[model samples]
Target: MKALVLAAGTGTRLRPVTHTGAKQLVPIANKPVLFYALEAISAAGIANVGIVVEPNADDIKKAVGDGSRFGVDVTYICQEQPLGLAHAVLVSQDFLGSDDFLMYLGDNYVGGGVTSVVEAFRHDRPSARILLTQVPDPTAFGVAELDDTGRVASLEEKPTRPKSDLAVMGVYLFTSEIHEGIREIKPSARGELEITHAIQWLIEQGRDVTATVNTSYWRDTGNVADILEVNRHVLDTTEGPGAAAGEVDPDSTLIGEVHLEEGARIVRSWVEGPVVIGAGTLITDARIGPYTSIAEDCRVSGSAIRSSILLSGSTVDGVSAIADSLIGRHASITTAAAGGDSHRLVLGDHTRIALAG
Candidate 1:
């Protein structure tokens, strides 16, 4: 079996960070989100993998080249536009020819991996298998309606009045039978071919389409709030006192579950985790704790950052406190007023701001 990872979407919700980098490349626990999907797929014993990407595919290519690093044979399938999920599958037909495949959204985070899901699908060999999870807002996702027997009866894409709370997760298992379904589907009102429509087509034709409700954590890291939520979820369950690879000064005090990637420097600071400090980042005389991720090459000094995500190349000057925020790449936050603005911010492209004040 092969795996097809859809990563072509231009993450408009993530803004400045996605402006500079792919949302799938965003880091959690100092590891890219794409890496998690790749790792899980690799663990599921699927080797031949195809990644669907947009025009900005160079960065992804550079990051996962040939997939050898992740123990899989990588193939890049170009999608000229972010049309939709079904469109992505239609474009990858050649790469996925004749083989049962798994489609994983590169930005989605599924706890405990998909090895079990793969096993269950392999055992059943249905026309299509989709993962579902109970989400608070089913209208935001492809919602599913189950029958009295608990089998999925129908599925709708972002319905106004959802029939069930079971929202379709990003992962999918499909046989070549889906090719015809994809071809028969029409574009939705959003001007994109919806995957949910194709699945509904299969159902209309009496194909056996199954769904597994995920009790484990699963998140479609689409918006800023969901991204931070996923980070927090991962940190909460990850093993305590994460892998340390970089330098820690003698004066620094590290506490709780923290992940310091290689080349990270912690000096004269108190870091309490559930936190991930990426490579080449420097932390000095600061307090980083309980759900904070400081990305690569960032500098933090004499500041306190909690429950925040500071993207690569950001800087927090002395006496600053950034809490429950998402700081864009190369952004500068300082306590000193600039042009009488109390706090100064030199933000990057596509940046989003929600200040407490």
Candidate 2:
């Protein structure tokens, strides 16, 4: 089996961050979201992968060149526009010719990977299989209705009145027969060729459309809150033995599962983990709280931060407290004057802010 990974979407919701970089490249725990998806594809025993990328996404291309590092041979397919999932599949027909493939979204995080599901798909040989999970807001996703026998009875894309809570997870397994289905379906009301329509087409023709409810953790890291939540989840679950690769001053206090990368220095500060300090980052006289990830080349001094993510080259100095935030790369947060006021900010790349009266 092969894999088709979509990384072409213009992430409008993510705003200024996505404006400059691919949403798939956003880091969760200092790792790009796209890297996690690629890792999962590799773990599924599928080495022939085709990555769908938007035009001018050179950064993504540079980061994931040839996929050799991930033990997969990658063929980059340019998806000219932000059409739709089905459109992506349509354009990738040549790369995916005559082979069953897994379509995985680059920004989606699936805990435990898709090894089990890939094995099941290989054994069962369903015409198409979709991963489904119960979501609180089904209207935001492509939902599925299951028959009594647990087959996919129907599918709808972001319906206003969803029939079921089973939202389609971003992972899909499809045989070549899906090509015909895609050809037959028309664009949805949103002017994009919806994948749900193609799946529904297959169901109408009596194709074996199967659904699996994923009980494992799954999240679409689209916005700031979701990204932070997924980051916290990754930190909480995978924080095993604390290994500090960098220098820690005798005066600093390290607590709980903190991973400090090479060149990261902590001096006279208190760091509470489940936190990861990236390479070349310096923490001095600061209180780094739990569930926080500070990316490479950052500096935090005289500040207290908790439950936040700071991208590479960011600086936090003389801030009283910061929580529940996502600070972009090369950003700076500092105090203008001594004040008791607290600050909350969702800053984008290259931002600079001085908190004061």
Candidate 3:
């Protein structure tokens, strides 16, 4: 079977970060969100992959080039515009040909991966198979209603009054019959051919449309909160604290489950783990708290930070405390301003500040 990973959506929700870079490239635990999806696809043993990209997403092309590093031969398909999920499938028909394939949203993070689901799809050979998970807010997702036999009876895309709390997970497996459904369906009220509608079309035609409720972790990393939550989850479960690879002065204290990558230096600081310090980052006379990921080439000195993500080249100096934040690349944060005796901050690159001045 082949794979189609959709990475072309304009992530307006993650704004100003998405304004400059692809949302799929956002790092969770210092690894890009797209890399996790690609790893999941490779683990499912589908090597012939087609990545659907936006027209001008050259960064994505540069980052994922040919997919050889992931052991998958990838073909890049241009979607031209942010049409819809069904439209993505329609455009990828040539790459997919007649092969049964898995369609995965590139910005999604499915903990425990999709290996079992892929195996089940291969064995069952359903016309369409979707993963469902119970979500608190069904209105934000494409929801499904199940019949007495637990089959997918009906589907709706982001309904105001949802019939069920079972939201469709971003991973889907489909046979070639889905192409017919996609062609037969029209755009929704939102003026896009939603995948949910195409699945509903198949269900109307008496095709085998199946769904499996996911009990494991699954998150769509669209907003900052969700990204931080997923990062914390992954770190807690998969990557606990570890030995420091870079230099650590005797004055520094390393607490639980911290992963210090190569070239990371810690001096006169206290670091609490379940935290990952990327390579070449320096933390001196600072307090690094739990659930924080500091990216490469960053410097944190004379500050206290917790539960935050600092991208590469960011500097945090002389701050009292920074928490529950997302700091973008090349950004700088300092406590002193040119005139104010009070707090002064010069923030850049999608920086979010929750503290009151």
Which predicted model would earn the best TM-score?
2
- For residues 1-357, what per-residue lDDT tens digits would candidate 2 score against the true structure? 999999999988787777778999989988999999999999889999999999888999999999999999999999998889999999999999999999999999999799999999999999999999999999999999999999999999999999999999999999999999999999888889998899999999999999899999999998989999999999998754465588899999988889998899999999998899999999999999799999999999999999999989999999988998888889988888757657767788898999872
Prediction 3 TM-score vs. true: 0.94
lDDT of 3: 0.89
lDDT of 2 at 205: 99
lDDT digits (tens) for residues 95-202 of candidate 1: 999999999999999997999989999999999999999988898899999888767799999889999999999999999999989999999999999999999999
* lDDT pick, better of 2 and 3: 2
How many clashing residue pairs are found in candidate 1?
1
Angstrom error at residue 346, model 1? 11
**In angstroms, how far off is 139's CA in candidate 3?**
1.0
Candidate 3, residues 1-357, lDDT tens digits: the string is 999999998888877767778889988999899999999999989999999998898989998998999989999999988879999999999999999999999999999899999999999998999999999999999999999998999999999999999999999999999999999999888789999999999999999999999999999999888998998998888753375477889999998888888999999999997889999999999999899989999999988888888888898887776777778877777765333323433244656443332
Q: What are the TM-scores, per candidate, against the unseen true structure? A: 0.92, 0.98, 0.94
Residue pairs with backbone atoms closer than 3 Å in model 3 (clashes): 241-257, 241-258, 257-274
lDDT scores of the candidates, listed in order: 0.85, 0.92, 0.89
Clashing pairs in 1: 16-350
